[model samples]
Target: MSYELRDHTADVAVEATADTLAALFAAVAEGLTAASAQSVPATPGDRFEVEVAAESREALLFDYLDRLIYERDVRLVLPADHRCTVAEPSETDRTDESDDPDAWRLAASARGVPLDAVAAREIKAVTYSEMALERRGDGWRAYVVFDV
Candidate 1:
């Protein structure tokens, strides 16, 4: 899994590619964290779980990054070390009467350090502009732009 920071007209952007959907998400999430922090602590401080469901893969990526921003602000930390799993709705979801039976789901665990402990920057929000998630050959790629 790898991610690259891209130049945007007036914002920051990231493009990540991985061999699996889960790794793709993890890479993009790491991009978001990299964009937000100048330096993150080497030792873990706080660990958190993030769960997000969306009707589409694009939306799932957006919501997942947005939720990380929310978690960072609320927890006063810079999140990192993302491990994620992305899946389509399963039979159990239908049996459980999920609100959106076709929604894609992402479950992730991450570690973070206090925001004040690092040199951090502000990312106002994750925007849908130029956002993309698609399979390329046998791998997946995701691109996202952040509103600064």
Candidate 2:
């Protein structure tokens, strides 16, 4: 239903839940805002198209956030609403792509922050070392950490 934020040693902890994997990923975006409050806005503005590929749902979640961290490091992106469509790799697949990923990428716009603009937060990275995505009953749940 909603993303929850928690305190960590040198970063922030995030969690979200949904009825499906796609929804769960979307919730994680909201959780990011809570973690990067210094650079993120209290109000949302624009939503961008973001596409990512990975081997598993957990990996997918990690890759997605790590990509965001990359953008953040590059000063091109900040935390905001994200709508993700997740799919697993096929058994016979060699090269990895999330559903022909080139066409499945997403674009998000932040309400309070601007990419490549001025920011004061020091969120260094989003790590997959602790990321998790699992189905509990009829809903999906996930957790991730951001290096601040």
Candidate 3:
């Protein structure tokens, strides 16, 4: 899993890639954390857990990133690193509840120090502009824009 910051006209953008959905989510979380502050302390001060569900993959990514932003704003903490697990319903796991039976679920844990420990920048929200998540030849890639 890896992430890189891209230049945006009025906000911040991140591109992340990984071999699996869970790793992709974790990489994006790390990207958002890196964009929110100049530096994070080496010590892991606190751990925050997040769980989110959405009907589709795109919605799931949006909600997941939004939750991370909410955690940063409300808790005044910078997520230095994260681990995520995504449960995407497979054919065997699907039921006949709806036409699209594959519901996406994500559970994540983030570790970070207080925002006061470093120079911080406020990320207002995660935006849909230029957002994308797709499969490559061997892995998945995601691009997200943040309202800074």
**Candidate 1 structure quality by residue, lDDT tens digits, 20-137:** 9999999999999899886677975878999999988898999999999999989998889999998897656654654677889998988978887888899889999989899999
Please, what are the lDDT tens digits per residue for candidate 2 over residues 29-115? 778765765544444345445567655566677777777666655545565756667655544433564345332233333333565
- How many clashes in each candidate? 0, 14, 0
Residue pairs of candidate 3 with colliding backbone atoms: none
Cα-lDDT of candidate 3? 0.87
Best by lDDT: 1
How accurate locally, in lDDT, is each candidate?
A: 0.90, 0.66, 0.87
> Candidate 1: lDDT over CA atoms?
0.90
lDDT of 3 by residue, 1-148 (tens): 9999999999999999999989998999889988987677786578989988788888999999899878877888887689999888566655465534567878898886788888888889999999999999889999999998
Cα RMSD, model 3 = 2.8
The number of residue pairs in model 2 that clash at the backbone is: 14
Q: Lowest-lDDT window of 10 residues in candidate 2? A: 101-110
Ranking by lDDT: 1, 3, 2
